[model samples]
Target: MSQQKPPLQNRVDPWGVLHAVQARGTLMGNRGILHDDQNRIVRHWAGKAWLSCVLNPPFEQKRSPFSQGTYSELFFLDEATAFAAGHRPCRSCQRGRYDAFKAGWAAAHAASNPSADAPTWLPIAAIDAVLHAERIGPDRRKRTHPSALAGLPDGTFYAAEGEAWLVWRGQSLRWTFDGYQRADAPPAGDEVAVLTPPSIVTLLRSGFRPSVHPTANLYN
Candidate 1:
């Protein structure tokens, strides 16, 4: 029998859930300091700005995952999973992606801005405010909403049988901490529990493509 791995309290899943899986994570992230001195998760989040970053940040000083820090390090399999977990790109480590996210946001939700010039930039904190509201429900859990499957853009995720599946080019990819597997897409026009936040879903609809694991192309 396979033995259980020790707890790291660092791996994040598509539903914004944390686990201790021993799989490779392609992205790094944080939600402020969430662990105790003994490396146990003591809170859901320490702050509102949940951010997804690169596995190896080019500029930031490297530190041990277990090192005591200003924040607890969180890891995700890919940007798609991270977005499903309500995380946006880290402004510092992923500047280009962050700008694209803002541009996408402006195009998605602020297109109606009366100003013909529109907004060239939207504050990350403002986006965080909206995401915070959408990511958490009144029941204080990962909020879910219903959406038409056929209408969801690629990279969007939905809940089915308690697992998260990514919508990609008319196919559903089963998300795993290791990688994704192609699966039958839902029937045309079926409504499912959308796991990605509404605002971010709109962002995908606006073409802010996220980086996915290489296996995605394998199954594509």
Candidate 2:
């Protein structure tokens, strides 16, 4: 039997030669902060953070910082780096982008893929259709504003956790939460209501204090 030799140790700095003499907080342009754990430059833009994969990061064509454009706060970089930095999609300029990305991501995820039925990409419109089918309504029957819940186009509204989602098709509504966190199941024969970002923000701006964490703040 052959004996394996011990692995050789690298004498060079892990982050790179350029950063050898620099301190930890030294900003290297697009490199962001050099993290020891991942050995990559990590940075947070918008609401998410990410780590750069390569040294010379590519510049994304974005709105000028001084100019007033729709996508001013947008950041463009490798997907791997974006995920590492811990950032989610922007609800405004990146709304469509996030919706598409999330749909494709959910479809490819193993949790979405059940036995016998392969995972499929559902459109945002489909989600609306499915929820409409549920026909949810308030229990009190005294006319009131609907709860804040909206679905993507894929015929399903993904809950906070990926485990379950809401499916609405006209008056037939169903809340699927088999393997995830969920509220009480929708009541039978009730008309369900969905809320969009703009409406939610309008309520918040009007002094509506929400008990839960605010979602869709960027959408408005």
Candidate 3:
């Protein structure tokens, strides 16, 4: 006689009760939640899910230090779920092989006639110019303010109780979000801005802390 496994339960859509669905299981990665039924893996974010037949593999440097396996496929419950999950297109597989694709995208936008405003990053700057070229109709509103992070020197970074960040040599600063929006600028003067990494953010949000006992993530 063969043993039987319990049927997978449906995942409750976090946004609303009416939007729930049965989910088989979940996979973890740098990206968001990857849920699956026995037949196909799906990634879910916000309230959406997408078919994950195509996997955007993680970069070599993105592997875990103490863990065993490399990153598997990027999955989602649906396309809306992926976007709501806050993932853009993968920098590796989907977008013109990443490098060439971004380069061409930047160049094409640069050729168009537009304002002379400069962007902090070249490729992103070019795209911004093209997107904001038109000025007509009602007054537009900006959501998030531009954070220049102009002063933080390269190689120097801050580590706070909440986040981990790296200040690159290219005058760019990258930090993970803690779900809470920061109102003030990073830090003034010589005080270093301690930034927690995304993994840390995920853990903290889940209610674990340094003083509290750590739970083993058996899935890993």
Name the top lDDT candidate: 1
lDDT of 1 by residue, 44-84 (tens): 78878999988877765677775776688899999999999
Residues forming the 10-long window of minimal summed lDDT in candidate 3: 210-219
Model 2 over residues 1-220: C-alpha lDDT tens digits?
A: 9986432121111111122221221111122222334232232112112112221224444423213222122222222112212222333335554565445444444243356564465454443333222322243111113343432222222222222233322222222111112245455233333322222223223332322111212112
- As for TM-score, the candidate ahead, 1 or 3, is 1
List model 3 lDDT by residue over 1-220, tens digit each.
Answer: 9976432222222111112233411211232333433422243222211212223244444542113232223423332222222222344444542344344444433343245762223543343332222111133321111223454333222433333233333332323221112223345344543232222222223332221001111112
Off by over 4 Å in 3: 1-67, 72-74, 97-115, 120-220
Segments in model 1 whose C-alpha atoms lie over 4 Å from true places: 1-7, 112-120, 185-189
Sort by lDDT, best first: what order? 1, 3, 2
**Candidate 1 accuracy as TM-score:** 0.90
Return the lDDT, model 1, position 215: 80
Residue 21's C-alpha lDDT in candidate 2? 20
Q: Write down the lDDT that model 3 would get.
A: 0.29
